[model samples]
Target: MATPIYEFAQIPRVDPAAPARARTRKVRAAGQAPTVGVIYNPRSHRNLGADFDCSLSPHVHIAQPRARAQLPEALADFAAKGIDLLVINGGDGTVRDVLTCGQAIFGDDWPEIAVLPKGKTNALTIDLGIPDDWTLQDAIDALDQGGRVWRRPIAVSPAEDGASAAGMSRVAGFILGAGAFTKATQAGQSAHKLGAFDSMVVAVTGVWALLQSLFASRANPWRKGARMRIGLGASGVPMEHSGHGDPEMRQLLFASTLERLPAGIRPFGALKNGLKLVAVDQISRRTTALIPLVLLGKLRGGLRERGIHQLTASHFTLSIDDQFILDGEAFPAGDYLIGQGPELAFVTP
Candidate 1:
């Protein structure tokens, strides 16, 4: 079956001429109304047929970029207008595209950002405390009165010698997962078919995977996991292996820069800043049954003996023999360098 695309309601398209008018400007000032630019994605699940409040004065500019390639042009136009606040109007995928494309345009000096949680999954919003019903007006108001949360996105790039044939090697996002995580993402599709989304989907798939791993034989896919070598920091020091499982393989590898995650899963344990990852080695069935409690922070100590390891570092490298999921997209198996991007401030209510 072809994959289904979920789009929320879309507002009427903004006038095509508005961008040109918006470009006729200089830089912003302390007292002037801050110039705002919005990158609206009409295809986001919660954005289908939705109407946005477009009457935010003349200083506000909006652009609807239909594809990922168009994101760079849209962001470039915004940068040229000297926008002070960059509003992203979709989900995590849209945010990833904007960050990846805007890197060349904004360099190290990025404008303040706000996100509207109008998509199937808004994990970033969960961390930022953005309301589900937040609108453009709310985002604008928050720009001045709201709290600021600083976060750095995860940067993924192919190793110099491992670049693909097309040389398309770099992308920036917030979440990364491998091993059973890839299967869990595949299972999430089924959860979507059942009308589940957000944390509910996470809870459902996580529970199902736990049961499967707890009961299935050693030969089962969930039990078999994936072959991976994890290296910590710049020196590429090998991750230590627990004697309970295969020394070279990890049953699960999940990494992220966001603090709060959906379903209250604390995969990073107590390590909350920068790049954090949890690697699970193939283990006995008893330990598999206790996995949920481990994630809930109920079980402590002897985790390494149980074949679970959580650590934080400035950066890391992953050499894997299976595909992994970044945000919601699947990337080919190879060597990758994962590190922190610019620390950006996100406006929140």
Candidate 2:
């Protein structure tokens, strides 16, 4: 199990309702060429030393943030310019950083957003149904012609009040997971090195993890999983234990706000919209073998008894004893409040 990196006393709880969001205001006419802002990350996987058609139009302003610290200023400039369409030319990490920094700048009144799948994993774009061949010019053209998909990123912050204000910080992302899910993310890095990405990496990692868990001993970290208490909604209600395996350890815990996941893994079963999560208990080898079927939404009856719990909620609190993966970044093991951020429109081709 991953050890806690920060003492619980050091991390303050955050008010889920406290995110600052200003009211929306009218900015531009429909016929006007939208003022565009692109936050491009040179270090992204696909952009490594590659030159892209950076000029969609002269009005499209681009900022390359070499480090996370430069992100705020870049977003602030866009906010000041009153950009109508904000295009993110990186992957999920870039989108997470931009959203985290832009939260305070644009608030609830965000400009229309676009994602260029330039990173190793572009789950957000996948959920938005963006085409793999989408380019800057395509996104720019779509600003006027494409459809809009409105989504709210999941907000995760320290559970202690006012802790997020003291540099402990909060993050917003489409997907968050812990336990074996984190291990799979680490393994996905190796897959990425082997030239796998997006859905391919997801499928590869899923197979590898399923095989390992199927064959490994119960003590195996992949099967042993993590100790976590997930509380649903404002009342902090504990999830009902299915009594299939270890009560305290969830073998697989994955959550997302995305309507569609990368590999078509319907872990959420028929549930969709809002915040969706699937918590699985350690099960027998037969059940372990059925994981692929479960992921494909093939095995469905009596899943909760089989140790698969799929549900949706407005908000949740995760008090975990292991590091959780948020958009490919490791967040220290601590109590965290998980809820929806502002619903913003994403332009799609």
Candidate 3:
């Protein structure tokens, strides 16, 4: 096979040092850019100039690294710099890094963050009002629009920093992983160049991936078994034992903070208003029943008993093997604990 036909400078690394607020981005106007900050996992960056030039506005204060190794230190650094608003340029993992950085730095002063959709998932970006930008102009619109302030809930986990599963990062704007859904991104998760950012191109990629999964599933030899313990409100009473029961099936707990999954996962939009807890108990139970409602691209669904837009947990702890996937970015960390931190703010689109 031939080598990749692209340059090497367009990758982004995950660094948590409080990303420096966007100072001289050029697109930001004096007193208008808000206290902007940028964090990108360059590996997720496409070599397209639109990705670079569109974000070159004066409003952007950037802290970019060539690899993911710089994330922790960068988050710490950005926090020390004191950013009022953070504009992340990578995918879901990078978004979580920003959330963690906010908690590490200005705890209560957590800045409202906007996600600039640039990665394969761009999951949080679409969760916000912004979505996949097919054209260069569309990309610019996201940049200009992301610089604005919007209000949204930040999933607060009661766990301490770096203690829970993936630490105390915000949700609603971030994705979580638990089951077969997350294990499928190995082929298309590239942050390389010549990235086909066109809308139709994404459609084709979706179909191709599905076909591969179907064939691979036929050849695979794994049967359902106990992977971890999970639940909805309590740890294991069963969230879906009432109808269409699966007395013998064991549901692997695969949850995401967002209402929808990246790429081919589905949603009609019901997930926009509340946090979704996708679970596995017995195979007969439906996980994310509202997912179809969300995939339809509509944001209507049943609300919590109190009509709340988000769920606040004292601290959700999951005990399992180290099989958890964070923001679709697999980690080598042990799965002893996992949850959201105290309080971090997220600007939904």
Query: Against the true structure, whose lDDT is highest?
Result: 2
Alpha-carbon runs more than 4 Å astray in model 2: 1-31, 51-56, 162-168
lDDT, candidate 2, 1-349, per-residue tens: 0112323332333344566444334466767777888888888888885655656577789898776667777887887777878989888988887888777667678889999998999999999999878988899889889999999999887786643532345667899999899999999989999999999999999999989998998799899889999999989899878887789989878999998998898888888898999998887788898888888888889888888899999888898998888788777777889888889899998
**Count of steric clashes across candidates, in order:** 12, 6, 61
- lDDT tens digits, residues 1-349, model 1? 0013311111112222232223234665666788899999888888885655678689889888777667778888898888889999988878877877776566567889999998787889998889899998899888888999999999887664442311233567898999999899899878988989889989999988898898887667787788998889879899998876677778899999999999898887787888899999988999988888888888878898789998998888889999888777677788788887789999999
For every candidate, C-alpha RMSD to the true structure in Å: 6.4, 3.9, 8.7
* Every model's TM-score: 0.89, 0.91, 0.57
Best by TM-score: 2
For model 1 the local lDDT of residue 251 reads: 86
Taking all chains together, the TM-score of candidate 3 against the true structure is 0.57
Give stretches of model 3 more than 4 Å off.
1-33, 47-60, 67-69, 72-82, 134-173, 187-226, 231-252, 259-274, 281-315, 332-338, 342-349
**lDDT score at residue 238, model 3, on the 0-100 scale:** 30
